[model samples]
Target chain A: MWKSKAKFLFLLPAVVWVLIFTIFPLIYSLRMSFYNVRIGQGDVFVGLNNFARVFTNEQARSAAFITLKIVVIAVAVELVLGLALAILFNRAMPARGLLRTILTMPLFATPIAIGYLFFTIFYEEGGLINGLIPWKVPWLSDPGLAAISISLVDIWQWTPFCFLVFLAALQGLSEELYEAARIEASSGWQVFRHITLPLIQPTIVIVLLLRLAEALKLFDIPFSLTGGGPGTATQVYSLFTYRTGLRFFDLGFASALSYIMLIVVMIIVSLFFRHLRQIYD
Target chain B: MSRKRKRTKGIIILVLAVAAALWAFMPFYWAISTSLRSPLETFTIAGLGIPFIQFRPTLANWIDQLSIGETQRALLNSTIVAVFSAVIALILGIPAAYALARFRFFAIKNKDITVWFLSQRVLPPVVTVIPFFLMMRSASLLDTRTALVLANVTFILPFVVVIMRQTFADLPVELEESALVDGATHFGILRNISLPLAAPAIAATALIILAFTWNEFLFALTLGSRQAVTIPVHMAGAVDTRGVQFWFMAVRALVAMLPPTLLALFAQRYIVRGLTLGALKG
Candidate 1:
């Protein structure tokens, strides 16, 4: 009995923290969604009105769609590039350690710095690409190009992350299995298809699932980069929430929008967990 | 020789890897280059469309940002918030980690706790903004270093607990039991035995929390105004205060990146394991 009490005491700080910080905020946001609370004004209940406003508002709908689009594209691109680099580096290679260290350097740079540095690099004529390749690209000015360009910056910083993880997973593979396949006169592609892919599939799933969550919550780069556009072309859901709640101080409506985002993210994360479990089992 | 062929293959891989490294590092290189170049050199190089340095360097921008009272204050605020937050997180988290790793408790599941903690990382900062602001307002903690520290602790604690639990679990428990048999109390066992073994992992965890708090923009942006702004918030404020001198901002940006970057270098080896949260769990 005494041992159990001591153990429960050990759990108190984390429980209290979660209660105050996470669970309380979640419940507070839910309650706020049902009320019409503005900073200067007092709270008044307005049930379902905030949700109605979200569904009917075209701008809100557009922001939701744009957020989904960015998540899908950016995550897909990171997975592919990360997997490829991992494979490339998996080969018996000289300077692999040095290369990895260099590539991972960007992972430590703050998103604000990345956004600022890329802003200069993507400048029309004076940028690095423009100087080297001799063709002017309006990397930030054009609306359609802006989202993709920012996504590229995220990929640059994060792809090395995926590379390192995947490399670790790949190195964990048993060389004896590959040797066995070779002894059986298996072709390289056959060996990779039969042996390597199956072994690394779990890592791939974990990587993609984590990256998807990250991409969906995208804010910093776009916030500092285009500031939600040449127009609203780059407005992710997070930025939309930021603009509504903090910038405009639309607490009630932003709370509703945020709740909607919360539900969507939870659903996606659940699906990702299911996929990960499938790989594991 | 077949061995010679293998060596050439290794050389080719090396060249390819080097190329990828250069591509990955270009923006950071550009940032440093822009920071070091003088205003005249910045414009001259910009006009010529050169990414690399082609002229004399200067420390004018670094001196300007560093010498300014407000910028220095922001840096001090950032240090206070980050250090205090990380320290608080460790204090609260390490014991919790030990409990989770070493014992079973009523209504407490380790995996559930870990997932719950990780999910907290995914919670949009905006979700907590309104409520946390209110909490701070009622407590009269707004625009103070304590507000920043508590707020940072709120975000950082979960990750630390999850990672430290893994770190503690990985350490052999016999060390502690052996101490316990020698009549050492629970606290003493924790202090004398577990801590020394887990120091590397604890330091790594501390560095990550420090980096996150240091670079945190949203909470600092919302909670801090005038009085307790952090370096990132300060850097963002720089956008309006001084219009982009490309060169000047670059230097200030590098200054901002310095501490976390150094921490990353010192803790680089433990980083891979720390980051994945020992996810390659057997």
Candidate 2:
């Protein structure tokens, strides 16, 4: 009995913190979603009206779609390129550790800084690409082009993440098993297709799940690059919620928007987790 | 028999690796080069970055940004929030991690507790940010560093619990068990036995948390206004305040970029394990 009580001490702070910060805020946000909340005015209870608007609001719906689109395109491209690079560098090399570290630098870089730097690089009048090209492109202005630009920058920053993880997973491959497989394999493609792919499939799934989680929250780059601009073309869901609440001060509707996004993200994540557990467990 | 083929493959890989490194390195290089250039030089020659080779570099932008009062205040706020939040989270989270890693609770299953803790990690900042924003405003704590610190703790705490739990779980338990038999309390075992063994991981975890909290933008943007602006938030607003001074914006970018980059360099060896939550030990 005393031992159990002693153990509870260890959990006290975390429990209290969750109760105060995470749990309470969740409860507050849920309550706020059901009310007509505007600052400098009293809250008026409006049952499910805000949630109904979330479905009705076209920008809100589109922001959700755009976010999912960018995440899929970016993560898929990153996985392929990163795996290629990882395979390329898996052999014996001098200064490989230094080289690996240098390649992974962007994983830790500030997204806002990366965003602005790319903004200049993509600038039409005197941008880096424009200096090399025969034509000036509307990188941030065109709606379709703007989303692609954001995705490209994301790819540049995150490919190294996939590369590093896949490299680690590849390095962890059982040397004896690989050597035995090599003896029987006829071609490199055959080895990768049969032996290597199956072994790294678990890593690939884990990487995809990890990347998807971070990518879903997409906020900083679009906030910096387009400011959700050229008219909401690149605005991710988080930024949409941001503009709605902070910029426009639509507190009630924004709360509903955020909650709607939260549910959507949770569903996506739970589905991924079921698949993830099938591999990991 | 395949020696010649192997040699050719090595050379091709070497060339591709160098090219990829250059491509990966271009932005950091550009950040430095662009910062050193004058505004006219920046806009006029975007493709050229080789200081004396491309254009004569200048320190005027860096010096100007460093001299600003808002820049100094924002940097200070960022440091205070990141350091305080990370420290507070560690104090609260480390013991909890130990409990989860070692002992199972009879009431709530350890797995369920861990899931509840780590679930905060994937929770969207906006969902919580709305309530945090309103509550902070009502509590008269909005735009203050304290509010920012609390918001940062909400995110950083989950990372602490998850990562440190892995570290503690991986530590050899025999020593801890022996210490307990020697009349050592769980707290004593944690402090004297587990902590020293996990020092490297603790430092790595702290540095990672600091880097993440430093780079956090959304909470800082929403909860912090005039008094509590972080480097990233301020850097985001640099173009508007200075009206697209590309050189100055470059300077601000470097300031915001340097801390996390330096932390990554210092903790690079442990970062993969830390980042993947000990899923991959790179």
Which candidate has the top score in DockQ? 2
**Lowest summed-lDDT stretch of 10 residues in model 2 chain A?**
A272-281
- Cα deviation at A111, candidate 2, in Å, is 1.4
Tens-digit per-residue lDDT, B1-282, candidate 2? 599988887888888888888888887887788899887787766465688988988999999999999999989998999899999999999999888888878777776677677678888888888888888988999889999889888898988888788788888888888888899988888898998998888898888889899999998888876888999989877776666677887888889888898887788777777665555677
**Candidate 1 segments exceeding 4 Å error:** A1-4, A271-281, B1-8, B46-53
Total backbone collisions, model 2: 0
lDDT of 1 by residue, B1-282 (tens): 999997887787678788889888777777777777777666457433333336666667778768989888988998989999999999988888777777765564556666666677767677787778777878988899898888899888877877787777778877777876788877676678888989988998899889878888777877888899888877778776776668867876787776786787666666666555446532
DockQ of each: 0.48, 0.57
What lDDT does the true structure give each of the candidates?
Answer: 0.77, 0.84
What TM-score against the true fold does each predicted structure earn?
A: 0.93, 0.96
Query: Candidate 1 chain B: minimum summed lDDT over ten consecutive residues — where?
Result: B44-53
